[model samples]
Target chain A: EAEVAQSPRYKITEKSQAVAFWCDPISGHATLYWYRQILGQGPELLVQFQDESVVDDSQLPKDRFSAERLKGVDSTLKIQPAELGDSAMYLCASSSRLSYNEQFFGPGTRLTVL
Target chain B: SQQGEEDPQALSIQEGENATMNCSYKTSINNLQWYRQNSGRGLVHLILIRSNEREKHSGRLRVTLDTSKKSSSLLITASRAADTASYFCATVSDRGSTLGRLYFGRGTQLTVWP
Candidate 1:
């Protein structure tokens, strides 16, 4: 079975530093999602993309967080001046359609900010 | 303000026993989904119950949805040690600007001891 791919399975960084995570969705998936999961809490959506255009990013902290899916196949999420509260598991998911029918998630990139 | 909230934050069961988790949501949803996550890993999709559907089953997992009550339940029958994980309930609203967006709950931690 094809799976979503994520890089930097673990990231440790100091507060106020910049960090980025990468994700590659399944080959034919057209919708990609970025989520942040805090300890003991379910994941929250940070951004959603349809092809190369962003469909929703209402919860994303626009001032510090940014995500882009340039070619629509892979995506990158960057945080400038990371904060201690930003430490969490970054998850990426993909689906054949834009709906939340059945999403396939990656192994995730665990970010720890000190 | 969370759309979905799961009950019994933690549960413990012996191998070969059954486990049940309940989820309640605050809004009308188009579909509800159940996901499982192992420690320090990403989530895996389990079962999805549509708003119009009352019950769904996949292998040993059974999911039931009550749109009138806005609640859902997941039952894992004849569970094994490998079934131990955090289970989350996610919903996609039928009415919203981000129609396809998913709202996830805090999840229930289940431990199945062999």
Candidate 2:
């Protein structure tokens, strides 16, 4: 069904370690989004990309988190020196510019920091 | 900070019963979208209602938006066990520079017992 693809459905790491999650959006989608969902809470936007360019990242914690969509098709989100509070489900979503109303989400990478 | 908040954090109902969830947002939005996520799974887009549109329906799902009150509601008629999931409301703000960025609510967890 042309779903967004995410790798390493689950990840566990030490608090001070580094971790990365990858996502490949649906083909021809121009807008990509990264969101973080804490247990019992709604997902929050971490970053947004438009054709390889960042459109919004105000909510992203730049001191420890970084995200990139170099080709505008696939994206990578990284957290260096991860914290225990960072444990959550990292989600990726994409939508076509023509029909920006609906977003297709990936299975997500559940990150657990010890 | 999340832009929307959903009512009734959790709901339990029998199969074939109708389920309703409500959402309220803090700002003017271009559109409001509803999504469902099963346990440990990705989100599935259900329906989207534009700010100008008051109501929309898809199969057993119906959504209504009240722009004046900055609120929306989702009603699922003839619910089944398979309909058990967490439902979330996402809004695209009209004041944002990007048109596709979504701000989500905490979500409503629904359980449909057979």
| Inter-residue clash pairs, candidate 1 | none
- Per-residue lDDT over A1-114 for candidate 2, one digit per residue giving the tens place of the 0 to 100 score: 799999889999999999999999999999999999999888888999998999899989999999999888899999998999999999999999898778899999999999
Q: Each model's C-alpha lDDT?
A: 0.93, 0.93
Shift of residue B43 alpha carbon in model 2, Å: 0.9
Q: What lDDT tens digits, residue by residue, belong to model 1 across residues B5-111?
A: 99889999999999999999998888999999999999998988889999999999999998898899999999999999999999988886564677899999999
Q: Cα lDDT for residue A109, model 1?
A: 98
Scanning candidate 2 chain A in windows of ten residues, the lowest lDDT window is: A95-104
* The 10-residue segment with the lowest total lDDT in model 1 chain A: A94-103
DockQ of each: 0.82, 0.89
Model 1, position B113: C-alpha lDDT score: 96
lDDT of 2 by residue, B1-114 (tens): 437899999999999999999999988888999999999888999998999999999999999999999999999999999999999999988885577788889899999999
- Segments in model 1 whose C-alpha atoms lie over 4 Å from true places: A98-100
TM for every model, in the order presented, reads: 0.97, 0.97
